[model samples]
Each structure stands twice: as C-alpha cells, then as structure tokens.
Target: MSARFAFNHATAKFWDQREAVEACARAGAGIGLWREPVQEMGVAATAKLVRDAGVAVTSLCRAGFFTDPTPAALEDNRRAIDEAAAVGAPVLVLVSGGIPDGGTIDSARDGVRQALAELAPYARERGVTLAIEPLHPMFASDRCVVTTLNEALDLAAPFAPEAVGVVVDTYHVWWDPQVWQGIARAGREGRIASFQFADWVTPLPAGVLTGRGQLGDGCVDFKRYLAEVDATGFTGPIEVELFNDALWARPGAEVFAETKAAFERVTA
Candidate 1:
C-alpha cells in the first residue's frame, strides 16, 4: 500500500543526536522527535540539521499537560506550538496530563477542553495541529487521563481540523474494544493526525511506562493496525516509538537496524 514509516528518538539514545537523524535520513525514513533532546541541540540548530540531512519530521513528541489548567501550563503549550512551527513539523502531540489535586477524571477532561479552547486557535493561527494522544489507562492516574481513541476523538470534535486531532498509538489503544470503530470514525471525521506503534507484554517491570516492546516482540497485530489506518485515508507516516529500557541501553545503530527490520517484517 506504500505506507510511509518513521522512528521516534527515544528508541535509540545510544546514538548521539546528529547520528540519529542522520541514520533515519540514510534509511530514507521520517522522524518523530522528543522535546528535551531537540531543546538540548537547540531547536533552530536541530531544524537545520534535520533539513540538511533531508529527513521529514512526522510530529513533535508532545505539548499539552493541561490537567493542571494553570496559565503557566497553557503558556508552555503555546511555546510548544511555536517550536513545532519553527521545526516545520505539522503536528504537536498532546498528552493530556493526569488528574489535578482533588479533581476527578471528569474534571481533568474539562481541563483538556479548556486548554484546547485556548490553545487550538493559537495553534491553528500558527499553522500547527494539536494531536491529543490517548495514553494507556495504566497511566490514567499519573501520566495522562485520556486513555482511549474514543475519548480523544470526543475531545477533538469541538475544534477545527487545523486546530485539534488525535494521535493513535498502538501501545495505548491495542486493548480498546472499540479501536476499529474509533479508527473508522477518525478517518470519517478526518482527524487522524498521527499513528504510532509499540508492542504489549506481560511481567511489566518497574517503571512500566518505559517498557514498551519493540515491534513484533509482543502481542500487537501490525497488519490490522495498518489496514485500519489505511482504511481511514490517513496517509501519514507510521511512527515506531518504543520506550524499552533494554532498547535504550543498546547501541543506537543496532536498535535502529533491528527496529527497521522488525517494522518491515510485521508490516510486510
């Protein structure tokens, strides 16, 4: 089907910043970058480097932590939009942060709505899209409260196309019974801003958040994910974003090579 592919920087920390982008360029792949690493290299310099290396940036890692609903947090997201624009990335992934003190999930969701109200228009004006990424329900308590594609779409519906959307990460939504339906709806509504893949596993060690499995190393069906996303007419890059500690400890080149091969194998 000629699907495009990309890699997230977290999968290969063993390679220095430049080599990671260079490797992706060499592989003829696109990239999704985390804010910290990019900030370290200086956003302008990082943009120049990626451009010089001829790599397409699929999306910026994240922006929103709106569960707090504070002015400072909202302002930070605004700056994130600026950074995404500066780097020529079309989408800024937003992870709706966890519940605020004494607030319920319902209240936290309201925070997302409020934050989006303020930030979506700003993002639209800047020519950047905000992609609300539904984190795993496992993270519902601390990391992010939005834990399903359906929920993400519900949040996105109130905003314009250029202003708000959803990031469908397999690691987070694989267990969702309504995932296929959700993907169909996302496609029908034209709101699929990003597509990411990672595997699921048992015996989750400490820091479960960092234990994302490499493609094909766990129980997700990539063929199904690919088919569904393609069915939506969403032609964006499929990004591989693993957070495995084992992977981070390996040589970056080795992780990249293995991940690329695994991606090809499963999608093949």
Candidate 2:
C-alpha cells in the first residue's frame, strides 16, 4: 500500500518557514510544523500562510516535557494547543520529557501521567489531539521519558482516544522487539494519531539529536512499517522527518525533493 507524504519542517530546520510551507504547497504535500517556527512567524500569520498556499498542517511538532509540569510547562502546552488549533492542525506531537534533576525515570513518568490527566480535557475541548511520541531509548536520559510505544500507549489509555493518542515514528520505535504488536494495539485502541519516518544511522554523534538518516540510508524497513500501519486501517499522511545535520545544512528545496524521493522509493 502506498502512503501519502508530509514533510516535517525539522527536516530543514534552518529553512525559512514560509519557504518550507511553499515547497510543500507546490508539491501538493502535507507538512508537519514545529512550534518555534510557527511562533516566530506569529501563529495567525503562519496559519494564513498555510491556508493561502493550500497546504495541510498534519501535526504540530511538540507540546510536552512535563517531567516538571511546572505552571510554566503546562502554560506552554496550553499555548501550543491553541497554536495547533489556530493553524488547523489536528494533532500536537508530544515528547514526554526526561527525568527531573534528582528524580528517576519512574518518578518523571508519574508526572507525565498527572500532566496528561490535567491537560486532556483542555485539549479535547479545543478539538486538538495530543500525540505522545516515544523517543528512542538513546534519548531516554535527556530527551524523553517515554521511550517505548507500549509505554506511550499505557500513558494514553486512561484518556479518551479523541484527546490522547500515540505517535509512531519508525526511527524511534523500529528497534523495539514488540513494535509490530504495539502498532497493532495502537490501531485497535484507535490511538495512532501521527506516523512519522526517519532512518537510524550509526556512529553516534555528540548530541544524538540530528543524526537521523535519509529514508533508505539506514536500516529502517519502511515497507514493513507501511504494511503494518496500513493493515491497521490507518490512511493518514506519513510524515518524513529527518534530523540529519547534513540535510539541514543543504538548500531546503533540494533536501525536500530528495527526501520525498527517498520516501517514495522506500514505500514503493
């Protein structure tokens, strides 16, 4: 089964936001936006840009990190939800933050549970779905406490499917032995909110934040992912979100074209 494509703006982190939107618009593809760029352009203006260009905003990159759930953290997430609604984005992707200082992963995960309970109603009221993204275990210490789809699904279960769901990014979950089962479960639970792609590469970089490989450049078998997710009856846009530093350094238009081609070739 062939999947529709969406370009995640982070794939070209340095590209002008308008240019990225225009590129996606020209290609008749969907786009996933990050909050920083949207805020930098002003949410209303960014909304107008996409609306005018006739581009679809598949999901908003983030709105979680509640290891602290500070008043500020929740406030920021509220604002993110508002931004997502303003831009007509149905899903707000969340990376449950890492453990707080002096705290264990278990403790931090508790905070995420509490935060979700508090925010789910708010998000649902606004018709925005908060998609919990389980980052790879490599980032468990610093980036996200949610390191597995099973864990993400568990966290999202207490809430209604319309308010909370899980993000399936191949780069993050492909290594898990139970990923296929996890995908099946997400489907049965009606919680597969967003599906993203980025291949895994080796020789860990210093930060490990921007080392994502192109679609076919690494070990991710995207065909398998498409099959598994499609078998579950999910026909949403498959967003390609590479964080490779080399791709970010190149012209965004070229990167977009190349990434789209890679996505087509792998899913073909």
Q: Which candidate leads the pack in TM-score?
A: 2
Residue 137 lDDT (model 1): 93
lDDT of 1 by residue, 199-261 (tens): 998778787988998888788998999999998888889899998889998999999999989
TM-score of 1: 0.97
lDDT of candidate 2 over 148-227, digit per residue (tens): 89999999999999999999999999899999999999999999999999998777666578889999988898899999
Model 2 CA deviation exceeding 4 Å by range = 1-3
For each candidate, give its TM-score against the true structure.
0.97, 0.98
**RMSD to truth, every model:** 1.2, 1.1
* Residue 44 Cα positional deviation in candidate 2, in Å, after optimal superposition: 0.4
